[model samples]
Target: MHNDTGELVAALDIGGTKIAGALVDGAGRLLARARRATPADGDAATVMGAVAEVLGELLADGRRPRVRAVGIGSAGPVNAAEGTVSPVNVPGWRGFPLVAEVGRLTAGLPVVLVGDGVAMTAAEHWQGAARGRANALCLVVSTGVGGGLVLSGRLHPGPTGNAGHIGHISVDLDGDLCPCGARGCVERIASGPNIARRALETGWRPGPDGDASAAAVAAAARAGDRAALASFARAAQALAAGIAATATLVEIEVAVIGGGVAGAGEVLFAPLRERLRDYATLSFASGVEVLPARLGSDAGLVGAAAAAADACGLWETAGPGGRRH
Candidate 1:
């Protein structure tokens, strides 16, 4: 691929619940945006249709100029080399040809693919929380826990584009059997659904709206419900363990966290900070700092653009040196 083309690129963020698209310029500012709900439960074609709709909206908009390439950050197991994806939450997309499909939709524009976590990391490292940090971990803690790593000042997307998948890392080896066929993974204990599940199982009921989500659980905890508090505490504890493990293994200087569950504010972070003291023991892991993500909901699309920039060589404005695991 040619390096840093200095042109506009189409960016897509595909998740189980939503597909967001945008046109981002050379400097990373979004020029146009579009979105569609993902038909995750539908057949493969149906899901593709939703993505097509998103692309149609962006491409059809008269205000935006034609983009030079397309970048997709998808819920994965994504194979960047093969240009395929198999997201766990979206069952219909096993080995889906996302890159080719998206390329065709955009009139054969060059397409780039990366795991959603890697996309987020790219965004963070480019202009968000991890911008100046040489080593960092960026995490999304919504429906599932996803993560990516930055090492020596560049995003590190390992072979097959799943290197920094911290969500599936086993923290509680003997704890619970996860859907990913792993036992005691960080996601099993720290994802939004898991948090709400633990709270509900512990006798915490939803309020008048009858919404039994992690937000509801957070609200209950804020209202001084002991069960809800306990649930978040447990999730925070697991997250702390996972963060410490990453720090110990890779020597990251910072951990940037984002997503729906992170919206719980201090209710989740307070305990998480407290618990980190217990797990980050080694001297090399002592200074690892945890911070809230700065990009908000736009991280995915922004990161998608950033990953595209990296893949197309548009993100090497600083210097030519880079690394990969």
Candidate 2:
């Protein structure tokens, strides 16, 4: 159902936790959506079944926007060249043929696949906090720390489609070993799970409910827990160093952050902004602004749509009748 006069794109945001689908208009607005919990532990086919279920709902939605193409933003390490994905969190999907499967499911519609981080970058650049910026970095710091870059006003997917993998970038040459076989990577030190792990290891115990998530740690820090505060401070320091390094390496005007750890608000950002001054001492990196992500929960879906729209050659004409690209 391709609409020549009123173009739309089908967008999918696939992660370890959930699979979300949407019909997005030319203006980057979500016209309809569907979601399903991901069966990360299931076999590959079962996991894909969940994705199919989500897509099924979108195709059945009553609004039925004329979907022109399909865009997918999946948890990486994804090989855009080969149309394969092997997200670490979803171990069952090692080297899965995602693009082909999705293409078949969508009746051979043209499809574009990008890492979730890259998709988020697309969303921010199109309609969110990074909107109007020429160069920027967007990060998602949740169960993992991942990022994407918009260099010279375009998304840089690199060859392997993992260009802006800031999480795996080794900030501490002699730091702890990461699951990605790296030493002192940003994700190893700054991810929410790591923050909670560090806090728990340093004699911080959960309350009666015994919830030891990063959110709980943030609450504890807010309640004046020294150990919890220290954990967040450490994570912030790592993030600042990473961000500063990114800015110094490639001049970016802003770094937009989101995800669970970012939900800590100033509990995480206050220290991050303060520490950035120490690491981003060079003139080129000094002016970089760190802003909270504006799209919130919808960033992934919107970003997926943005990617699709870009692929469909609609960015120049697809505005809210007049929204800037």
Candidate 3:
């Protein structure tokens, strides 16, 4: 549906691999967009420069004037209250003031910040698989496993904006130590890189292309590679444990899985669904549904806009000079 409110928000999705920007409307449509490869090894300023470049593209668009606010979805842990982010994968961005910098770049527009997982949840709840669900968990299982919750039909980002970060929750006590100082965390097992690592350790060789990504492993799994299938199965078990734990704690109605690894289709979902039954045995949790994300690559950008629109009351209350009331 078209947004009759004429509300437009600029959105930024910052990850370890890329920086994406878009001008999104209230109806979850992208009016303009831009992206740049993240210089993951660069200093703080250099990383910020890439963000600036993406924003420059949006700013140059003819629709720029109608933009009412800015939204940022950055890899966590993010301090939404303080507008700072310390994403685990982006080492150079410890405690970076992303909101302030984006606000300055956007000429003082109101800027709202949320963890990338929270942003994805907002988008899913607004326009994707979780839209009609009153309680849900949305997960991104790519370079990392990030998640956010929606409860009572609203995004629940917690005080620090990292409420539903299930990636660090220990699923195995004796498992390998995660970078977050935890052992057997979901990300350590279920993340794409970890999936590839496990497949390689178990003697799953990549094809002639030498692409050892989780996608390649998934292809091998589809081709009946035992080692590749085992790796994905292990990842699925970890994911199922995490999802069941979350469902048991929150009574979520559904778990929406997304991101690069999720693109593996049945290679991930078939085992995930089967394993979920093993863990989610409680009556309430057993009824929980698992589904793939529908928003695809645009989820982060759309979610960032959804978060800003929700937080700033863009649809209902506008203060002087188009600022949120």
Candidate 4:
């Protein structure tokens, strides 16, 4: 997979905020890239149009002929078996036939579809923090929470490509209700918006700019705001419970945290690490390591390329199980 074969992967990372496209080489380098803001409130066709526009930019390059396949990492819950996506944030798409649409746009090139979390796992396992680990969990904690798993040294996206969606898992039996209709879900407790909301409810005031985001609460926590600290501690506790449960169930070795919330640095990690000690007490799960993701914002694109490479048979090892459609 490391050798240069002059073959490239056309990668698309579709999210609620943006749609990004790139041409990536076997070595995980992005050659050409394009992006557009997601028309999140628009109709399905409008969203697809944005995706088409991204691909148009990438394909317009002189090296388009070198691209062998297209890989898409979209917000979940995605059905890899059916090549469809129903991202919760993007209301216009419900069971959208994304793979077929991309195939039509790419002139029938092979396309691989995966959940965004799975894509991040592929990127981390292939080249980032989870590299070389036999089993791991990677999480994206932002406005919403999502995750993916790697087990036995390979990405494990499961049948629906959402195996490691830890956010919806209940950590507390009688806590807040999640939009997913579940009570006490990890996302309901630990997502950035929830963190900020909790802080506000507990008497944490915003600055003159009225920035009441989680980042602001994190800064307040760093400055010794009791309410902000308590909010983060609660979020950390919920996240720890979820992570520990996953580690216990699957015997993962590490948990890689990423996305905007993780940018809070020690304000989040310090409490999270301390709380994980209480929940992950089992011998097998006790040694699980937690670390920040290494790839930053480019993870989705790189992971999409990794999935494409795997689908194209360019890897020595099998990737997360899925068929190109």
Top TM-score model? 4
Q: Whole-model Cα lDDT per candidate?
A: 0.87, 0.87, 0.90, 0.90
What is the TM-score of each predicted model, taking all chains together? 0.92, 0.94, 0.93, 0.96
lDDT of 1 by residue, 264-305 (tens): 999999999999999999999978998999888888888888
Local accuracy of candidate 2 as per-residue lDDT tens digits, 1-325: 1234677778899998899999888667787888999899999999999988888888886544577788899999999899999988799999999999988887888888989898888888888888778788999999999999888777777776777889998889999999999899999999999999999999889999999999999999999999999999999999999999999999988999988889999999999999999999999899999999988888888888887777667554222322334
Worst 10 residues of 3 by lDDT: 316-325
Error of 3 at 50 (Å): 2.3
The candidate with the higher lDDT, 2 or 4, is: 4
| TM-score of model number 3 | 0.93
Best prediction by lDDT: 4
Pairs that collide in candidate 2 are none
For candidate 1, the TM-score is 0.92
Write down the lDDT that model 3 would get.
Answer: 0.90
Candidate 3, superposed: residue stretches over 4 Å from native: 1-3, 316-325
Tell me the number of clashing residue pairs for each predicted model. 2, 0, 0, 0
Tens digit per residue, CA lDDT, model 4, 48-124: 99999999999997988889899899998899899999988899999999999999988999999989988988898
Model 3 lDDT per residue over 215-250, tens place: 999999999999999999999999999999999999
